[model samples]
Target: MTTLGHKSSMDHHLTGMSDNTVERPGERAPLVLNMDKFSQVTATVCRVSEAERAPIAWYICFTLSLGLLSVLGVCIGYLFLTGVGVWGLNNPVMWAYDITNFVFWVGIGHAGTLISAILFLFRQKWRTGINRFAEAMTIFAVICAGTFPGIHVGRVWFAYWLFPIPNQMEMWPQFRSPLLWDVFAVSTYFTVSLLFWYTGMVPDLATLRDRAKGKLQQLGYGLFALGWRGSNRHWHRYERAYLILAALSTPLVLSVHSVVSFDFATSQLPGWHTTIFPPYFVAGAIFSGFAMVVTLAVPARELFGLKDLITLRHLDNMNKVILATGCMVGYAYSMEFFIAWYSGAMYEKFAFMNRAFGQYWWAYLIMVSCNVITPQLFWFKKLRTSIPIMFVLSIIVNVGMWFERFVIIVSSLANDFLPTSWDSFTPTWVDIGTMVGAFGLFFTLFLLFCRYLPMIAMAEVKAVMPQADPHGAGAGKHGHAHH
Candidate 1:
């Protein structure tokens, strides 16, 4: 037993006991918590040895991802040389591959914000394990998504022309245009996401820096961490900043997609002009984004031996979210059909029909099965806990989400009010290559993150540890995953 007097150490307290206790003269009392391994960071901390991974697997991941990035480059170069003709967009379908890709990536980005910000605000202690990587994924996925619209414009050199800087050219990008709103929405989302991801990284970076040995390592971590120290005072302020930033990011999460919806909603196209676009788009975003996260996380968890940290419980939690959002999107589909018929608008009715049974009928069916029926497997706990099932479901969700975009873009334009101009849609190699490249781009960044960064938030995990708790609960401040 330790002394409980001034200038002496105190014994650990019982978990269920009241944190506060008043002692009469000379009475022995314990400090609030029993500091132990279980109490630390909820198993989120990477033991320094665990940080090392098989370098060859990492190399292969990087090489493939880089090759894809190069392919994306070649495709973009070809697009610049050959013009928009390469994408199979002609006649009434002025926007096809670019818009489809834009929506797809935006949807892929939603889960990161939900995992990092929304879950944090809810004080879901379970998020401590994978939130760091999820936030990182958010930043890179947005980068890939933001690039599509940027390069989709033919003149990649003057892509900045989307910016509304006052110039001698006497041309200001029209704020009234939905395209300009995309310019605003995407850029603002990217900027804010970058900031949010970086702020979350500061503490994690400091952990890495403390563990670093060399001079260059010291400087690298020092600069990136912005001179972070594990002072309680610093953490107190840093946490408040993080919470405020999360609050800001949550709204942008909604507004960015809503603005993207506005690009279609405000349009006059039969399929595009609908009030359901905003909420429908948001639900689809979360569904697709969460699926992508599982796709990426499955590999990382196994390859990195993070199964304990990224437990099956976490996957199950995310799967439930995916299932819920999938249903929401499916309901939106029914709502669209109902509204189309109820409104008695022939054009809208025809657009929904053409989506289901028109030239793109296969695309619509694929979307329906993947988004609506596929996630139903998640109702069984076994499917979610099974890695292979999770993997296949992830790919299915991504395919469906892509089809959702294709359906949105292709069906709307291919069979608009003018029957004379109606044309079917097909994606060219350039479209397919760029899509492949975006995956490459996402993985390349993620691989680098796994290599250098802690891949998990070490400090945040520590904060949830029983020792980190100012008030004790049980033997530790935090409970065990198994418990």
Candidate 2:
């Protein structure tokens, strides 16, 4: 009788209701909804990977992504054969689409680490739903970002020189260059993020291993599962490793993008040289990264039938972040002009003026409208909660961010100090194809990750669920009674 009463009280507390009671107006909604069992969570996430056939949408997306990947390959091959002259690299506009795309992709990679490491450290339970794929996105985005500098070096074979390894010729990388800083910063960020991502997935991989049917399936999943037996020791070590990796990754969330920003901030170019670039770049990176997350989350939830696991609450929270970061980006934008004018340097003032009303005024307009104006719509609760609205806004934010980099790079460089050397930049077919191909690479990898790996962190999600509580309901009885 005591056990029964205790179970009843626990159920009531977990559900926030009973037979005759109602949930209060201010009560927080449950993270997982429309599901009552841990098995259901397992089934929902695992089925996508386990199912023999994926949805038609997956095939359609895969086909398109593969085609684009081929385009990227062909473009890269052509560039290697024909030389960098194939790009629209003019006198002053030596840096254009390549750097723009590099920065854009690097920025895109930021949100995942922030969501996984920073939020995890803060004990944000809501991150459980989206962190898995976000980490995957981070890895893939870095892969895409790394491609640019590899090819941008022209002699792709000598790219190994970017590292500090000694050679027969005693050629060494210029350690002081921010460009070298990018090589180390980005590589370190990727290594830590990959470990953090794989560590979180171990238990889920073990779950998949147990549920796997065939011998081949068992072997494959088992290998990655690292013999995870869900024992107390296994879990204790996993938690420790995860916490340590999270700590290591937290500074990287700020440092990597800041290093990327240093590539420009360290330069003497009028618009490029700004102390604000570090924080500003970090904000824009997070801003664009969250937008990309939302961009992926919406379709993923709908297509994979993961609405219960990744609920509206998650989307709402992410949108709120987008809004907050969007504001930070906007503030950064205004400050650029303020500081330029405040400095009273003719060239600095001219750079700011030229960005708003110069040869590339159209790009500037697109950047402002997309980055500044579009995210403002999220200020309204109705719009923020609406799936369709947020998706469109997310994409728009990324487009604006791309243009933001374009305006920053092309505008400043195209019209440098010497009027005689000023040249209007134009992207050739190869330039457009290479950028598009990077997208293909990103999506192709993401689709494969979604198909093979658990998209949601099943272990973390379960940890957040009410039933996982040690003291709830059958706590005393379960402790006394053997399994």
Candidate 3:
């Protein structure tokens, strides 16, 4: 009787039930809204995957994605037949769209590990709503990012030599280059992220397996489920593995981008040679990453009728992150100029000046306006919460970030010490097609994932709801207690 009374009172407080009750200023709004029952959460998420046919929008988007993917394939085939000369590789501008796109996509993958591992460690319950697909985005983005370096090497057949392996020829990868560091860092990051993503999906996969009506569905989901029975022992192991992976992934979120920064920082080039690149790259990465999340989230929530699950609050919070990181990136931009001037080095000062007013000044201007100026609009609550505004702003943020890379790489390389050899770089049609094709690849995988997989981490979402409390009102009613 006492326990029941206690549970009822706690439930009342959690639910904000009393007419006179006022929400405290610091109290977080509910992460999941509407459809109070645990079963409702399960049914809503499952319906997207279980539907006999996806909505017409899915077909239209998928068709477009497939077309882009075909474009990517043709471009790659042409490039293999032709050469790296097919790109706009000029005298001084060897690294143009290829490196820029590589870094952009790698940065795009950062938000997943951040949302999943870092937020989970901090006990941020809101992460449960979006982390699943963010992780999927990470994997796909990495796949796109990885494509560049492989093909950029020119000798695609000899790409395997990038790895350290024994052979009759005794060829070994250069140990000193930061480029090699990227090989290890990105590959390790991908492996761990894949494991983390799959581990989180096990219980949810088991759910799909049990809910399967067809034999093939059962077998496919069951194969991946790995005998998840929801037993306490199974959960115990599951949680331990998850926590460990989260811990592992947190460092990776910091390390992967830092290593990527090393690609430029280790160089002797004036603008590229700076200590600030690590943190700057990481911040810009998270900034652009969250923007991509917003870009995808806005469409996803609306298309799938997930407005209640992925509420305005979620979008609002992500915009705030975008705003914060945008400030960091802006600060980094100013600091680069400050460092260049403060160092009393003519070459460094010239490098910074050239970026602002040099041949590629237009690119630099776009980078600053899009990356630094655009996100400031989020400071206003009304603007940040507006769906259409945030969507457009999110896309703009990515465009700015891409230009950020372009400005950093192309500007520095184009204006290297000897002005006599400097030449303007103009990308060929293959370059534009290849970059667009990478987008196609990313969306193709993502669309398929949404169609077949549990787009939400169903078990994780249930764990955060009020009814997950063992002593709550809904406890024991429908076996909704989180395992």
Task: Name the runs in model 2 displaced over 4 angstroms.
Answer: 1-27, 473-483
Clashes of each: 6, 0, 0
Write down the worst ten-residue block by lDDT for model 2.
Answer: 15-24
Q: In candidate 1, what are the lDDT values of residues 334-418, reduced to their tens digit?
A: 9999999999999989999989999999999999999999999999877877889999999999999999999999888888987
lDDT of 1 at 155: 70
Instruction: Report the CA-based lDDT of candidate 3 relative to the real structure.
Output: 0.90
lDDT of 2 by residue, 1-483 (tens): 123334543443356321211224644356777555679899999999999999999999999999999999999999999989999998888899999999999999999999999999999988999999899999999999999999999888888999988889988888899999999999999888898899899999999999999898899999999999999987888799888888888998899999999999999999999999999999999999999999999999899999888887788889989999999999999999999999999999999999999999999999999988889998888898888999999999999999999999999999978789888998999999999999999999999999999999999998887666655523445553435
Tens-digit per-residue lDDT, 210-286, candidate 3 = 99999999999999999898999889988998999999999998999999999999999989999999999999999
Better of 1 and 2 by TM-score: 2
lDDT by candidate, in order shown: 0.79, 0.90, 0.90
Alpha-carbon runs more than 4 Å astray in model 1 = 1-53, 473-483
* TM-scores of all candidate predictions against the true structure: 0.88, 0.95, 0.95
Ten-residue stretch with the least lDDT total in model 3? 13-22
